[model samples]
Target: MIRLHHVAQTRSFRVLWMLEELGLDFDVVPHSFFDRSLRDPAYLALSPAGRVPALEIDGRTLCESGAILQYLAETRGTLTGTPEERPDWLEWLHYAETVGSHVANLTQHHIILRDPAMRSATVMRLEAKRLEKALEGIERRMAGDWLLPSGFSAADIAVSYGALIGQRFTALDRLPKVSAWLDRLNARPAFQRAAARDGAAQIYMQAFYPPPEETPHA
Candidate 1:
């Protein structure tokens, strides 16, 4: 049986959406970032870093979400894209983390820090700008409806996770293609299914977390 450890609105959502896209029958082992459950020894055994998206499949467990997506696509013989497009596919897949890093920093400053004093307005503004630039790269690279010219592939599912969440910290107004692409992704049936199973909002209580206003230096 395939089992996926998931937390709503986390990077694990990438794996959850991927599983739905592949039409795989799997159980979602729900987890929370608020509770100390992730720190437990049992969960850690599955994910050494105490992170989400730890998947149990084919008699072995996988931790990283990107790796899981590649394994599933290759083993299932679908969504891997054409062999000639492998380089682009792999590049987009890993680039998801570039977008994610900014989101993580923004989330930490905007949400996880709890006390306002503990959060750095400078970091928030900087990360938001960085996230916006990363998304701009996606917009510039979009020559079609999806990341790859070969149509929808696992690369879309892998990288879109960041765009989906990054919007909270960074506006997509100028990135029209990225916004349109996100709309198309949200309209997918598999993406809808994953959203239904995404559990409750344990994090990101606000609809939008705007970056702090820029301080003018004298």
Candidate 2:
């Protein structure tokens, strides 16, 4: 049996959405970002770092989200894109993390840090702006319906995860193409199905997280 250890709104959502897109029959083992369940030794055996998106399949477990998506595409014979588009596909697949890194920082500062005194206002603004710049790169790169001219693939599944969450930190008004692209991605039946199984929101408590520096005085 294929089992996906996942946390809602986390990188694991990439695998969850991909499984739906691939029409694979898999079980979702839900996890929470706030809970210490992931740190349990038994869970560590599946994912050394105790992070989500630890997929158990073919008698072995997968840890990283990007690697898992690539493996699933290759094994299932789908979503990898054509040889001509391989470079772009790979570029975008990895670029997801570039955007993700910033979102992670923002999430940590805005949510995980908990104590207002522990978070840095400067870092929050810097990361938020950096995230916007990274998103703008997508705006420029996306000269077509998806990341590549070839068509939809696992690249979208990988890259779009960041864009979905990135919107919480950075406004999409400057990213018309990305806004439209996200809309298209959300409209997919498979994406819709994945959304249904995305579980409760354990990470992002709100739809938007503005930088502390930007918050107005009361």
Candidate 3:
């Protein structure tokens, strides 16, 4: 059975959601965020980064959320796009990873990482602006849905987690196409089941409402 090392509110959600899409039975291994237990020596053996969403599939371990999604999609053959379309496919993947990484960093440094007395104002503002630009770029590319010309591939899965979960940033209002895409993704039965299994409905709901902007630099 496929076992997913899941940490709630992390990129692991994307893996869980994809497993749901595949209709495959899997086990969810829980991990905590407050500590680096995930980075323990044994776990690190499987995932050098010591991050969540590591997968143990029939005794083979795999890490990195993006790689995990691509593996599952390829194994199940639901990954659309071919070698002829490889350029666009790889482009979409990079776009997803690039945007998501920037946004997540912004969220972490600006919002989640708090030491009110020692916060870096300049870093906060810079990350926020960078995140804004990244979102704008993503919106432009997604004007035509599904990331690539082929529609609904692992590329979408890679990007959707950030789009779906980045509540600390601005809402998806300006990016109506991406906003609509989020709604459409949530509507899928697979998404629903995965969310329920992961018990992430409340977290997903919370993501819909953006928190008040509290830029330390401002």
lDDT of 3 by residue, 37-121 (tens): 8868988887888888899985699888877877787778876466677677667666777767766765665546667665565
Candidate 2 to truth, TM? 0.96
In candidate 1, stretches whose alpha carbon ends up further than 4 angstroms from where it belongs are none
lDDT of 1 by residue, 8-87 (tens): 99999998998999999999999899899999999999999999989999999999999999999999999988899999
Pairs with backbone N, CA or C atoms under 3 Å apart (clashes), candidate 1? none
The backbone clash count of each candidate, in order, is 0, 0, 0
Could you tell me how far off, in angstroms, the CA of residue 195 lies in candidate 1 after the best superposition?
0.4
TM-score for all models, in order of appearance: 0.97, 0.96, 0.84
lDDT of 2 by residue, 187-216 (tens): 999999999999988889898998765668
Q: Locate the minimum summed-lDDT window of 10 residues in model 3.
A: 200-209
lDDT at residue 116 of model 2 (Cα atoms): 91
Q: Please report the TM-score between candidate 1 and the true structure.
A: 0.97
